[model samples]
Target: MATTETAPRRPLDAGPPPLVADPAALRAVLDGPHAAVRDEVRDRLADQSAILDESADLTRAELRERVRDLVVEFGAQGHAALGFPPEVGGGGDIGASVAAFETLGYGDLSVLVKSGVQFGLFGGAVLQLGTRRHHDAYLADIVAGRLLGCFAMTETGHGSNVQELRTVARYDAGTDEIVVTTPDDSARKDYIGGAARDGELAVVFAQLEVAGERHGVHAVLVPIRADGEVLPGVRVEDCGAKIGLEGVDNGRLWFDDVRVPRGNLLDRFAEIGDDGAYRSSIDNPDRRFFTMLGTLVQGRVSVGGAGLSASKVALEIAVRYGLRRRQFEAGTPGEETLLLDYGMHQRRLLPLLARTYALSCAQQEVTRQLHEVFSQDTPDADERARRSLESRAAGTKAVLTWHASETIQECREACGGAGYLSANRFAALKADTDVFTTFEGDNHVLLQLVAKGLLTDYSSEFEDLDQFGMVRFVTGLAVETVIERTAAHQLFERIRDVLPGGRDGWDQEAGLLDPDYQLAMLRFREEHQLAGAARRLKAGVDAGTPSGQVFREVQDHVITAARSHVERLVLESFVARVRALPASPTRDVLTALSDLYALSTIEADRGWFLEHGRLSAPRSKAITREVSALLRRVRPVAGELVAAFGIPPEALGAHDLVGPPPADISG
Candidate 1:
């Protein structure tokens, strides 16, 4: 059961009090969490506002024209193929590329997603999967928008299970050409952003067949159109307009017998020799495929960053509106309450605002990971580091995009009728970004991948501990048990000091605020979920059940594990960023925000804690109280927290927040 704090009654003549924040400190947050290449993308946004506004209201044809215009504009400005090699006409900064890519969301999502599809996806595939020859042939043109291309990986029928794609690239040794064809209608490339118009090329993915043996999926650069006309063996049809993103000419493509030189294969990992012998540099096909996929993973990070920026826009609009809009007065004569003064209103938006901050920090960490893993040639790069990059990208993309979607809706409702006005921006923001949950990678499917990664690693440990390895295994378990007991005792002692009566009862508020306590709580839930899932799956395997059957049995459990794991990542990232801040009132407020994020997250999922006896009933009851108080603490600074996103004045649709000089409400 939960209880809400009541709002204080105000006098009749009161306008909403001006609550302010440290813009300088907020600017630091806008710079992101870690010490790395601080991207100037947001700074450049002030100049792009007019272009964004121009594109926002265009018809489909005009929208297509705008996209084309932007392509050339971006290319000329050296912003198009930013993440590619320097020799290939790019900025040669992948992290900055993502940061700049995300900044596009401030204008229009159609533009952002379309940009991602062209540069990050299509050109990225050519860069990551293709060899030096392909780069020499197409890289410069692609970056210049002289050669437009599609990333033809997702078929209509095999978006999630891409390993089973029906398209084939059959090698004809006599012709020294590879013939690419879609097996059937189901294999048509669908939802391809640039395919409807302007695409001259595609990096089509299909199974490779050589000497009558089928190899796993690989990509080859195929010409789909020439001089603005569909090519001889290719057919393209528009996806026929949708709910939003009208600017992108999304289309479907069906290939009949497209032929390209064998050299066109993007064969960085696996290759076909001149003698027609198929071979891969990496012996493990799974490892090779995953590695290729990892190179293109910048798309996921880009999408998450875009979602984060959109969340900021939404929160700024809603919070600013909340500050200015006044409603019914039940207390003082003639006085109407500012929307944020209501406890219910704070409960609704503050937590979501908190989530946006958490996501902002998490996305920054992911950006650092992306740079660390992708920048240099790390032949001996730790496998864990790469997996961490990919997994974090996947998990953060799923979490933040969903957060954006949900937060946008809540913001819309919070603003009532104004949110529905097309000019207000929320309507467009909601409609356009609705697909981010499914784009790049479907959030649900991507989350499952995160869980699978955990399970795969966990299962490997179990598999290695076969009967012959029992002695080592038993010793490991004994060591783990002892460690758990020792750790638990230490935690209990810490909790005792915080307790008012020294172990007589809990200092529930102090316990909740303690970073150590929060981490331990989050750790326990995630480990509990992972361990439980692992045990269930293992039991099924031991019972001689089919592996697929075992997987299906624990699928939901693993999803829960995945969510818990990602939530822990956000909270941990939040705490780390809070700790890194120089001590000041700004640090203190951010610390409170960090606590709100953690405690509110627990409050939402309190059932699990209660069910597992991880939290006592009395402590659980305090979770709500503390969370309510946090909402109050965060209330005064909500607008400034969002302003930290550095959204340009033209990009933000609301005005009340900016009209007043931001005050130092951190006091």
Candidate 2:
């Protein structure tokens, strides 16, 4: 149980760059714009994290008990229903709900996900897809930790394809009840968290049938367990151990003629009438299904936000270690250089730090949109905004989670052997979050969702998004590299730069800082590639290919287009945030980090820009050079930037782990 307490072998490195590394200052940056909610949750977790941290030695049963205790604690604080309506025993502050969910990642990932499944998925379904009847009856208990439940949506055969799940809920006209059944093994709910032990009820999703009419996928609450016993006709099996999140008791469930009151149907969008007929507010089944699932978008955003938190925590640990872990002498003989002083180490971790900061900013925007979309009545909500929020949620979940995976792995490597040790936190952080790329929804599938939104006249879909506003604002800019052709804009600038000199429309420093420039390039990439992909898809269809085949032909392009949209979202969000900070020297450092995030992302994707003539070769080269320069500019503030993450000192681990007791030689 003893952790390696690494101690500093020598004095600390010379003063870091001027950006504040004060825990409070760095924490302020990590907390983003909503400091109050973010800090409240963060400080709460920091105070009570011991109870939440899962150790390697705990058995599955032990972990489950620990998780249960944490759930009780969360419920006691009313966090279980923070996003639910105040009328339904919740605070109705969706933003605070999301903040609390994301903040839990600073402790244990298992606990983080368990909280998500219980509150975000289970409670959210009742609150979002159900009417007054379900809420008035179950909301208080669910929020009070008196009714632990599972969200049984995914099946062995339909992990991502919810529409095709074979689980059936047939109306029994004579009894005025609904009978839920799994046709076979493939239809059993797979990976149902809380099912193995704690869950007593479930929000079961199945294809509902009334009068032989099939309703796509609908959720209905079914009693699965009572008095600590599995209900009749309900079978549950533990998923057992996993590579990580052992503290979460994941399991599978099967039902055989599980009957519930017909009112069990969460009939917010659709319902069955007493006359044995099916009815719905929305006529189209596809749209109705999407509308139902759309209410659960906060889960995806929460997962993505959790991923960011994990990354921030990992970076804080590694970068803090790197600042103190000394290696072979470089400039001064016998005076070892700090790990962070090495450019190689800086390259390994700093950009990731910058990227995490960018994602934090983007997540803030997504969380805000989530609050705005769900805090009010559905009918009065903006359809455009809803779609935009879904797109952002999908894109952010896909991109940010992937970023977390990459950042965590890089952080481990940057810390060398110390990162691999259990005590140091890297192993736990990486193992627990390794599933992030596939969490909530598979990254590829999520990206495809965003792509579908873009191909469906994205200009209109994104018109309400800030990215579009930035695009319009950038119509005229002090762009760098004028007279050089990239595309339409370049040609226009070329005409204006007649017989060029320094007077040409090139201002490298100013251009990189321009919000107009960053957003325009990002939007241009998104629009152009989407248009190309659409053309390819249309041509494939015209050639008499199956719709699925046509989609497959341009799948990669579809993913690329989605990536562009997400990158634009991140860049726009970061810039807007940086620009909003009060004027100060620290603000300048943040602005530099924002610029680094933009330029580095652009540099990574420059080949696409060059291929599409969006960025001429020279301009593309300029982006790389600028990115390198920003890396150096950011180096001095690297410690401060990561310090801003505000990971507790204990989690940061020791600078030089006390070497394991010198070889027990001379036994």
Compared with the true structure, what per-residue lDDT tens digits does model 2 show for residues 428-476? 7888898888878999988887876665534432323232232222222
Best by TM-score: 1
- Backbone clashes for every candidate come to 0, 3
**Backbone clashes counted, model 2:** 3
- Give the range of the ten consecutive residues with the poorest summed lDDT in model 1: 1-10
307 in model 2: Cα distance from truth in Å? Answer: 0.2
After superposition, which runs of candidate 2 have C-alpha atoms over 4 Å from their true positions? 1-26, 51-54, 458-503, 507-510, 614-621, 650-667
Instruction: Give lDDT tens digits, candidate 1, residues 93-170.
Output: 777787778777776677677778778888889888888898898889888877778888889899977777889999
lDDT of each: 0.76, 0.76
List the candidates' TM-scores in order.
0.89, 0.88
TM-score between model 1 and native: 0.89
Tell me the lDDT of model 2 at 512.
Answer: 48
Clashes of 1: 0
